[model samples]
Target: MICLVGAGPRGLAVLERLCANHAGENELVIHVVDPFPPGSGRIWREQQSPQLLMNTVSSQVSQFTDESIDCSGPIRPGPSLHGWLQSHDSDADQGRRGPDDYPSRRLYGRYLRWVFDRVVADAPDTVRVVVHRATAVALEDADNGQCVTLDDGNRLAGMDAVVLSLGHSDTELTGKERQLAGFAERHGLRYFPPANPADLDFDKIDAGEAVGVRGLGLAFFDVLALVMEGRGGRFVPSDKGLRYRPSGREPTLYAGAHHGIPDYARGRNQKGVAGKHRPRFLTADAAHRIRENPEATFRRDVWPLLDAEVRTVYYQALVAQRGGSSAASNFLKDYLSEPDDPGTLRRHGLTASDEWSWERLGQPWRPHEFSDHATFNQWLLGHLREDIGHAEVGNVDDPVKAALDVIRDLHKEIRLAIDRSGVIGSSYRDEVIHWFTPLSTLFSAGPPPLRVEQMAALIECGLLQVVGPEPQVRTDPTGACFLIGSATIPGKQIRTTSLIEARIPKPDLKHSANPLLCFLVETGQCRPYHIPDPDGAYESGGLDVTPRPYRLIDAAGVPHSRRFAYGPPTESVFWFLNETIRPGIGSMILEDADAISRAALTC
Candidate 1:
């Protein structure tokens, strides 16, 4: 019997690959384990509020393999999530949804569940798929194989293979968070620690109380939705933009980030062109170069090509949008002159900043000063309106938007470089993962544009406020309230009775609160992933995995063939593995899954 832990989307992808590889095999029995639903998992579970919507468009989501995809295994061409929903005669609501529409996460969760069920039904009679609705708490090496201990004190042994597809873990309060918690308890202040935004209880804070929020990402959007619309406020169409009609039930929210940068509003989806972009410079040749040379750094070798790709796309879009214009001609001349140089692009006024200062994605303007909250709200409202306008025009017509789209599409190539070099423990990898990745995400993978417009309306109505460019939070000495201040707006600090951190913590096995992960580390079944720094110093934090087939590397510096891992924990090995699995060229998730499944078949 084979075992798959944490039956989320990643797990399902791995399982599907296995089924394809081992179809009609009578002796195979796969035991799937997770406390949450198998396919949707915890984050995308159906229980989430409908207000929470998917960032990706409907047509982009699929659980089945398609003909266009060149999978190493069997190609099972099936309907995408949107196509499947449209095919069903019973679901008229889902049928009416189009390719470009961003559906509610709840509805998408249902589709995932349906996909999981379909996979099970289509499996060969010989392949027994047993799903256990219990958490796998621990795994120990046994005389025969690995023994998996469930949360209920039951153990299953003699597993031929184990796929660790564990999804995002709950964040444990760290240094400042722990201190804040203690301060909250002592002072009777409210402290909502890092959690799934949907799971938050809004009733904890009163209507008029000021609440400080940390981070400005997708989670922050959910928090904003809950704090505003969930409290009986409504966003209506208006001449200026969306106008908010408040029920006066929301607490005054103050939000800011380190850079005081909000996520770039998502651009309009080009329905038919998902995964269609092909990189010219960031090709297989570039990947091989990284693999051949141990001295290669991502920033030095790979970023130029990635940056050039974006510049090329941006210039192309500009030329197309302003055909025959002098501006377009100038852009084309500069772009063609040095096709692969960012300095050339910058000199020729091809940068996003050069094209349009305010429309630039992910680059925050500094020292945002407002005489009062009202003035700050007005500026924020205007900023959102401008961003929404860019989105409405679509990326092809919007040069800044097109550049952001190009950067987003480079995820595959970037992942390829990471895979080729295995830059996990290096300082360059650290810089890329910590700085570059987040910047790319903000520019490319932000919320749907409509959400930003709605948020503007909320700000206009005083429910939300941009308190600072980068706000720092500290508990009061007397333990009465939380003090939030920004360096940008010095001497201007706000005291709030409550504070909530609206961001997910990175996966670190050493500090993981999950019982299974903790047990795995304690028992020497797995060790924290580490790689050498530029000076040849090794660092650890990421979950360790063998180079190929992704077997879990044990404490004794050995790879266990019967075990494998993918997704978030394996980020150091597979840098961009923290996304939904899709059937596309250079899709590491699919590629890794195929490799793991092939290994499983042999074992």
Candidate 2:
């Protein structure tokens, strides 16, 4: 018997692998545990609003096995998500979508549920799947193997193995956030901690009330849509751009992030480009060397390869887009290579605004340049419009846009390099995982272009204000409102009755509030994952796992082969974990499931 916890997409992948590998009449029983339905998971639940859209295009996602995937047994192939939707023959507006169109997340959720049902129905007669719609709160060693205790006080036992596939963690508020909540309650003001934007209650905020919203990424877009469109506003395209018609029910919003850098729009389809960028310099082999080396630092060993790949693609695209004009492209390259150098700018005949734009492009918060709110707002408007232009032309037609696309493509190779336990050096792992990955994600994997245009329109219409970058909030002395300030606009301040942190909290095992995680940590069954420091100390973060078979490592330093872990909790071992799984597209989730299933079969 095998127990797969949290039956989301990762859990479904494991089941698929297990079912595919079953050969003879060797009876196998797999139990799936989750309060919600399997496959679609909580993040992509069907109940979410239609206004919430997936960042990925229809053709980019697949629930089926494909030729590119290599499993331990015979292959099981089926339709991709787009193919499945087409097969349904539904006439709903979201249905019958094209390859390039971004489907509503609710529609994708339905596709996931369909895949789940099909897999279960087609499983071999020798395999039995039992799903338990209950939350697992604890796990421990049983006489036969292991046991899982649910929140309802029932316990499941006699499991041969357990695979932890806990998806995104809806983290508890931090101490600061808790304090903010207390302040809100005492002062009779509204305060919401970080949560899925779709899950937030927007009705509590009345029309014309100023609300301070933190972060300016994809979540903010969701909030903007709910507060505006939910209030009977409509977004219509005009000759100027996207024009917003308000319903006189919108709240006044003060929004910005640490860098005040709104995500770049999703690129238009590049004609003749069939698939993702094929890395010339940063290949799997190049990344393999870093993986094999015990002491290779990310900055010293890995970043150069990535840098070379970016520069290579940028120069190539520039020359190709400029009709093979190497001389002009070369000058432009020199200008980018030394953005702050006046001599280089002069050589390229670039204007002051051009130089400033390049500087701000590299570092989103060049604080010295903007004198006040008016100037900063002007620069932001121009910057977003120019970026939209590049996105409109398609990544291939614009070299800079193409280079950003290539940065996203690098994720696959990066995942392959780090997925192996103990392959990455500790410091390099910390630097890459903590710093570089999030920053790159902000720029490359942002929301669709239409959403950004809507946000800009919201800013222009006075419904939203761009509170300068890195805005921090605190309760005012009288405890009546929150005082918000930003470093860019020193001394100046804004006050609001409500505050909302508009970003997803990072997953950290040490601070996790999940009942299961707490129980596991409190006991000796599992512990926070740790890596060795240069000074021989240890730095712990995620859940520790054994290298090859991906078993959980306990506090006493024993590998629990019968209890494996996958998904976000294993980030320290796998570097990146939040991506949507796609067949033949470097699907690390599938690779992980295959390995775990192979181990379970042996047990």
Candidate 3:
């Protein structure tokens, strides 16, 4: 028997691969374990509010391994999310269910369930799949095989091998968070630590209450949706564009982060599933060379190639927009030959201001110092309007969006350069992880354009207030509330009774709230991955595992032969574990799943 824990997207993919590779020579019993349903799992569970939508368009997401995925296992073609909706005749029923449309998370969960059912139904006669709708609490070695204990006090013994595909997991709160929670408890305030937005109880926050939100990423938007539209508010077209109609049940949200701006809106989808930016400068060979280097750092070695790649696209799009397609081709040829020469840019009618700057793009609010909240809010509104304009132009045609889209497209190559101590560990931690990753994410991986439009409308409607840049939140003992201010705009403190941390908890094995992970570490079944640095070993907060099959490594540094782990659990070991598998791209998700499935089958 082979056990698959956490039946989320990754688990579902692994199951698909296992069936595809099954020889059918012997009986195969697969046990799938999770507290949630087999397909949607915790985060994407079908019960989530339909107001919470997927960031990705329907055409891009797929559960099956197609011909695009380069794997040793057989290709199992299946419908993309859009195709599935069409197949079920639900596309027309659900308004705006086109290929480029952002489907609701609940709808996506339904798709995942359909995919799971199809996979199970089409399994070979020799394969038998049994699902345990209980969390796998513990695993132990059992006489040449393994045994998995579930939360329901049942045990499945004699498992050949087990795969841990635990997706997003709850993490222990940090010292500051703990202090905030303690203060809130003492003073009768509400403090929510980092969590999945869907899990948080929004009703606990009183209507018209001043609530301070800590992070302005995707989760903040979810919070915005829940508290505003989820409470019966509506967005109707106005002379000013989308105008928000208040529900009066909405709480006033004071949201801000280090940047004190929402994540950049995703460029409108012009390119379909098959269209992707082909890297010219940051190619596979270039990434390989950087990976092979002993002293390579991301900023020093990798960023140059990445910078060139972005500029190449940016300028080519600029030229194409101005001159023509033929001129753009000639410009690319010349730019490839003399990438550093400013004369080429000059000849193409490009100025220094037209040059791409990731730093500038990331921190657009850095240059200005707002005197007050109103001044800052006005500036922010203008910024959001400009961003929406660019987004409306679409990712393919817009110069800026097309350039930024390179960051998303070339992520695999970037991962290749940084994963598994490819770059020096110290630089990897400080430069790549702390610096570049967040900036790149802010630029590329963001909410849909419509969300940004709504955000602007909310700001105009005076429902959501951006505190300021470089936001700082702390407990106010005197006021008995949370005091949120900013370093950039000082002397402007906003006090609130409710404080919600609008971000997911960072994965830390030592601080994981999951009982199985805690048990694994305490029992020495697994250890946290550490990157080697000259100063000291940097703890990565991810499970240490071997390459390929990703066998879990123990405290004594021995790889467990019968165990494997992947997805968010092994985050720092492999970069960007949360990204879903795209249909046409050679997705690392499918490749990793295929590897683990093949290895597990061998047992």
Candidate 4:
């Protein structure tokens, strides 16, 4: 018997494998636990907001290891994206592509839940599944097996092994964190902690409010999307690009991340983006150059090489047609389309006359013709009829968002390293890990962790009015909510009363400040697959577990087994989420069920 914690995707995957991969008619009882039932979907996919899009494409999101195994699709044999979509919608057969690229994250969540249910239904008679609608608070060991403690009074007494599937955790607050809020208790502050945004009661919020958003990143974008698109109208990314209409009265968002002003760049080369999954641009020349330069940091040694390659790949397709008369016409159109002011002609502004174009370059197929914000905007409006509204969009991507993307991509690179069994603690490994580790809790931590700088910026701007510097106090926008001292970033650790059980970060090695930091400002549309990430924290090998709400404790007290755990409150632990489902547990249930079936086997 085993216990699996957290009913998220990873937990469910383990459970499915347990049942399907088992050979003999061995009896095993699997315990699945979570406040939400097995199918409620994890934080990332389970969404109340339709506007929130997935980071990965649907074609890339199946549970199977093989890309060809497309069970997540609408049909079994429909491994290719087109086949599956056409099967689901007969009308899709007429089109080359139909809403298949980056489908909704909300839809993907539903798909995961359905898969979980199917695995349970098809389980062998030798197996029994149990689900606990509770959080696993603690892990204890006793006697021959392990003890799994649920938040409620109940407990699971024994288990052989626990495979942890805990998801990302929240990043916490640090120094001078809550002072701004505490100081402005009499006034107001807008501290929107990362929680279930839909669960919030928006009516309580006043209209025509001026708010200062702490981070100018995707989370900030989520905030904006929620306010604009979620408030009323639907959000859709179309041929026209990101479009948003009136969502009641939009708030005046005052966003201030570390990079106060975002730096914009000319659109990068698009040749790589044309490839299926975006090709890696690790050239021999660049590698040699990097290896040769003694003082080479990635910025000095590799960026220029990558930049040139990306541009080459991007413009290569257009070489033939670029010399045509339309090129001049397009250039004229680009100039004529812009507003009189040069500042208004920038890429970040949603309305900027930029674009994504396609033309039959004298060679094979349709090659891209234009690649700038103005051209992209024009293409979308003319062809797709979509437009993303930005009151004052930055020059390039919001710098903080770009930084996070770098960190996120760095994690992918690290995964590649792990897959190759690459050794760590080397210059490269250390460089990469530094970017990813900080994001673990954000990827999993409940009641999301805010950075110290995020906290400081709010306080400095008087957006979050401060009270007690050490022991903080603050007031919410509508004056309906008030908070005690929460820490600020850099030293976002503070101890006070009210709301969450706030704890300060310890000055241990785990929380030591990383000095080798690079504020990578831009990752143009043409970023290479190999650049090191700035936001990635640490890369460890033990178990690539998420920063889950539950804890993973080794069952030292279980006398029979060497390393076993009762497991986290696995969402689908009952069937087979932790080390494959077995058909035995609470011995009597297995004995009786097996005995009845075995005797009937004679018939």
Best by TM-score: 3
Model 4: lowest-lDDT 10 consecutive positions: 516-525
Evaluated against the true structure, the overall lDDT of model 1 is: 0.75
Question: Clash totals for all models, in order?
Answer: 1, 0, 0, 91
Could you tell which candidate, 1 or 3, scores higher by lDDT? 3
Superior candidate under TM-score, 1 versus 4: 1
lDDT of each: 0.75, 0.77, 0.89, 0.36
- TM-score, predicted candidate 3 vs. hidden true structure: 0.98
Stretches of model 4 off by over 4 angstroms after superposition: 44-47, 67-101, 180-188, 194-204, 233-249, 258-312, 315-414, 418-603
Error of 1 at 474 (Å): 1.6
The residue pairs found clashing in candidate 1 are 529-542
Stretches > 4 Å off in candidate 1: 68-70, 89-96, 271-275, 324-334, 339-364, 367-374, 420-424, 538-540, 583-586
Best by lDDT: 3
Best-to-worst ranking by TM-score:
3, 1, 2, 4
State the lDDT at 158 in candidate 1: 92
Model 3 CA lDDT for position 265: 90
Task: List the RMSD of every prediction in angstroms.
Answer: 3.0, 3.6, 1.4, 15.8
Tell me the lDDT of model 1 at 480.
78
lDDT string, candidate 3, 13-32, tens digits: 99999988999679999999
lDDT by residue for model 2 over 1-603, one digit each (tens)? 999998888898898888888778889999999888888877888887777888877777876666676666556778776777777865444542877777877788888888889888999999999989898999999788889989888888998999989987777778999999999999999998887887788899988888999888888888887889878899888899988899999888887787776878878766321367787666889887776877666667766677766655665566556446666577657755764467764564544553323345655657557767656777777778888888888877687777778777778876655554334446545667666776677768888887888887887887887878778787898987887767775456678998988887667777777778778888977876665556553445578888756888888989997989888877676676777876566466787788888888788
